[model samples]
Target: MMATADEGVILVVEDDGAVRNLVATALDVHGYRHREAASATAALLDLTSSTDINLVILDLGLPDRDGVEVIEALRGWSRMPVIVLSARQEDADKVAALDAGADDYLTKPFSVEELLARVRVALRRLAYDSPATPTEAAIYRNGELLIDFGAGVATRGGEELHLTPIEYKLLALLARNTGKVLTHNYILKEVWGEAVASDLPSLRVFMATLRKKIEPDPANPRYLQTHVGIGYRMLRVEEAARL
Candidate 1:
């Protein structure tokens, strides 16, 4: 079944009582059903006990275990969307959480509105990516950018884009995982095959070229967003517009 925007339960895991309450209250105000857990153990227990948890807002500084461990454990069996809401603002911390399978990362003292927006985006992506949702067309569209996977081509503003083989592969990879941040290592393995070593410099060159083809203004990219030391994300049209 195609879940509605706010149809599923969201679990908020935070060791701080004030922050937990704040997040939970915001969710409640926004008409989202949510559960709270103060530790990784409790969070994992709730996830295992209930089949209704479709998303998680986790704090990395958990009392029992770090949130990345929780993400790793969850990834062992589930592909559920996890948004890390932590005080850790380091680029390495963000990269670690993302590489561990977190869907998004938000620093501490975050905006409640931004948090809700991320939640909405995650749920929508879940619905779109669902096996039961009937995405047989296999086409990806965000604003002027359209990737016709069936035809093995991409177009912008009604014109076909002339992309090299490597550029095309990179575009296809990001389009397939739209709205999610993909790590450099993940992209390298997918595009260049598993045997390829960490070639971030090459990836950056390819991505820069790919952006020039799709983005109207490559200097300020509207489609592809860079997470600096982390990786990249394909923003949906609406999200890109706000950027």
Candidate 2:
């Protein structure tokens, strides 16, 4: 998914030799180049040292150290896309990983197709993993508040935001449309996929967080205006001269 005309690398960190090779081979068949690390320490080393690694498939069970530690440890500075692999299929487990900055999670005995799809979702979440031109990428700016579409960075009142993956995705979607009347379904499709379009509760929570970050007042939203049954919009602020 590198913008440049070269192969991008995906790092697979799994303790199981068979699983590691299986996942790596699947990626290879899908035309993605990759490297593998068997232990958490080596994974950290690969993550820290490489500028080539675009994404990671991380196993939560490691030989040398705890897998959650690897995530907590990597999240200290890196924002690279991380898709956690876990044998536990509990909702709490998935939530925990997501809350800790993992992009997505896959339970064991997963299909290769699903694995590739999750990787695609992670790449999409990263907001500039494709070969799109910088100019074509969507962005929004109003004085001190700025949203860079290609960079996946949001700033408000002149300070950068440390947004989660879902938050960033929602921001990009709204920022792209700006004044347009984007429906709730539209927003869901753009951010969480069509499958979760009816999951308004989840979307509402994300929207509320987005308002708190970008709006002058979350209760009385200024930048992000809600249209009730409709979706939200990032209002285009007019210059003082216009008034």
Candidate 3:
């Protein structure tokens, strides 16, 4: 079945009434069903009590608790997509939210169009990861890049791109979660296990090398996008084409 904006229920968690209303209005205009929560407690209650909430648009500052805390709490069980919408512009804040398990981050005074675009991406990823869909494929293709997971090889434009073992692991991890942000800590834990979970420097070095192998112009990358202090995301082929 084709996915539509009306297919899932979105939870909008913002303490600021004006901002919350604005976000809710945009979702309503876009034909999306949504629920609103003015505080972290309310948000968490709603999330835990309801199984139909498909995604979340959360603000960092809440009346009762910090948004990152809510994200961490939510991550304790749910893999539901959370997009942090905050006034906190610092890379540190963004990294914190992502590390706490947010799927995406958008700073306050954001463009509605961009927010909706991100919502679409998140929801699409949710659908893609749903059990109804096959979790893994023998091969994954994005434009000229093709990763044959079964064969354990990646190629670009019909040519095999030699990648280090670490690079290959990183590529496969990102590819599997395309369109979702992967924090340094999360990537490290997943790819290298807990022993080197704090090794951000090594992850950066490996990611740099991986980009060079797959990207036609590493200077202007079309596939992998760096989120500065946050982490990295593997853009879907259609999304990368726009970049």
Q: Against the unseen true structure, what C-alpha lDDT does each candidate score?
A: 0.80, 0.74, 0.80
Q: TM-score each candidate.
A: 0.58, 0.64, 0.59
Query: Model 3: per-residue lDDT, tens digit, 1-243?
Result: 223655679999998999999998888887889999999999999999998899999999998999999998988888788888999977667656666767666777878876886677667655444343233447888999999876568999999986544567689899999999999999977755554466575466567667877999999899999999999999987898797
Model 3 per-residue lDDT at 79: 75
The global Cα lDDT (0 to 1) of model 3 is 0.80
Candidate 3 local Cα displacement, residue 119, angstroms: 0.5
Tens-digit lDDT track of model 1 for 87-151:
98766686667667676667878888767766776676565444432454577888988887656
Over the full model, what C-alpha lDDT does candidate 2 score relative to the true structure?
0.74
Can you tell me which runs of candidate 2 are displaced by over 4 Å? 1-5, 121-151, 177-189, 192-243
Best-first order by lDDT: 3, 1, 2
The superposed Cα distance between candidate 2 and the true structure at residue 186, in angstroms, equals 4.4
Query: Candidate 2: minimum summed lDDT over ten consecutive residues — where?
Result: 1-10
